[model samples]
Target: MADTEKTAIAAHLYVALRRVANRVIDIEWMAQNEEYARAIIKFAVEQGNEELARQALRYQALLDGEPAPREASARAEATPPSADTVKKRYIGTLR
Candidate 1:
């Protein structure tokens, strides 16, 4: 990649990392920006974060109007929800 492109990707990766720290994943960004999604997947792999990589792949598939792979979908289904998601799901009921 050109230096400018690399810089842009780096900047976007930082934003993506920040979102991850905030427990937020912008699937919309991943779906719309192929380079950003690739960057996230590459970063996740380099960092040995399989879950994040899988999520990026899934988001890419969804945004590209393709069904996720059956095995990946099954594994994703088996994965437990994040604590934040659980809280959000039950918060209204607790009111």
Candidate 2:
């Protein structure tokens, strides 16, 4: 593809990503219209906009009351209580 065409497509993805991020595009549509959402996300991935695609998925997961996989994994890595702390807190219950 020509440089201009690539730039234009990138700009389009940027706008779409921003619209969803800013809530201007009603991300709830992602949940209600799965095909449309998948098309947007697929285009983003094809164009190498993985982060934008991920953001779109995150929006959908948020609408569904769940964390996106990356977000969940990141949370799991964030702050696990130490084994000692858990043991101390649950000592009586464990016994």
Candidate 3:
């Protein structure tokens, strides 16, 4: 989509985001309307808006009454050791 369209879409998401934050709109309702919530998250990701996407996901988790996801360090701790963990094959895979 054109830049103008993306901006407009982002603007709308901002309004929706505010509505969620201010509790003018029920979060449970938004959570039930999964597509709408996902739209904001997807847009943020597509636009390279990492902060926005992270916040949106956190809010969505709250709305859904789900536990927030673990932080990166915690995730690392939870991860099972891979074969050849010492070498860490993925470190070279990106090259």
Candidate 4:
């Protein structure tokens, strides 16, 4: 990736991580309320912050005394759809 793209990605990753960490701390401070935890995860996923979603999942695992889910590697391996795919889907919807 170009330096600019790399920087943008890094910034986004940091923000997502921060949000996840904050949510986790909030849950802990709230006495491990399941409702609060679920709300955080749902909001993260709904906002298309996959990193945050994964972090929330890991938090839940740890809360249950299980191993946290594998990190960075799993996300890095998944390919997002290309512009061509999006264009095709958009055109199809016009039919």
- Winner of 2 and 4 under lDDT: 4
Error of 2 at 40 (Å): 1.1
* Deviation (Å) of 1 in candidate 3: 36
Q: List model 4 lDDT by residue over 13-87, tens digit each.
A: 346756655432343332336565556555666656667666556655644666655555655457556434655
**lDDT value for candidate 4?**
0.51
The estimated TM-scores of all candidates read 0.36, 0.36, 0.33, 0.40
- Screening candidate 2 with a backbone cut-off below 3 angstroms (N, C-alpha, C), the clashing residue pairs are none
Ranking by lDDT: 1, 4, 2, 3
The residue-level lDDT of candidate 4 at 7 comes to 35
lDDT by residue (tens digit), candidate 3, 1-95 = 22323333345446655654432333343444657656656554455455556556655554456654433466667677733374465775844
RMSD of each: 10.6, 14.1, 15.1, 14.4
Misplaced by over 4 Å in model 2 are 1-16, 19-25, 53-68, 72-76, 79-95
lDDT of 1 by residue, 6-55 (tens): 34334444455566643333545654566766766666545545555554
The collision pairs in model 1 are none
Q: Which candidate achieves the best TM-score against the true structure? A: 4
Query: Which is superior by TM-score, 2 or 4?
Result: 4
Q: For model 2, how does the per-residue alpha-carbon lDDT over 13-70 read when each residue is reduced to its tens digit?
A: 4576665444233334544565765666665555445566655555445435564444
Candidate 1 has its poorest 10 consecutive residues by lDDT at: 1-10
Error of 3 at 89 (Å): 53
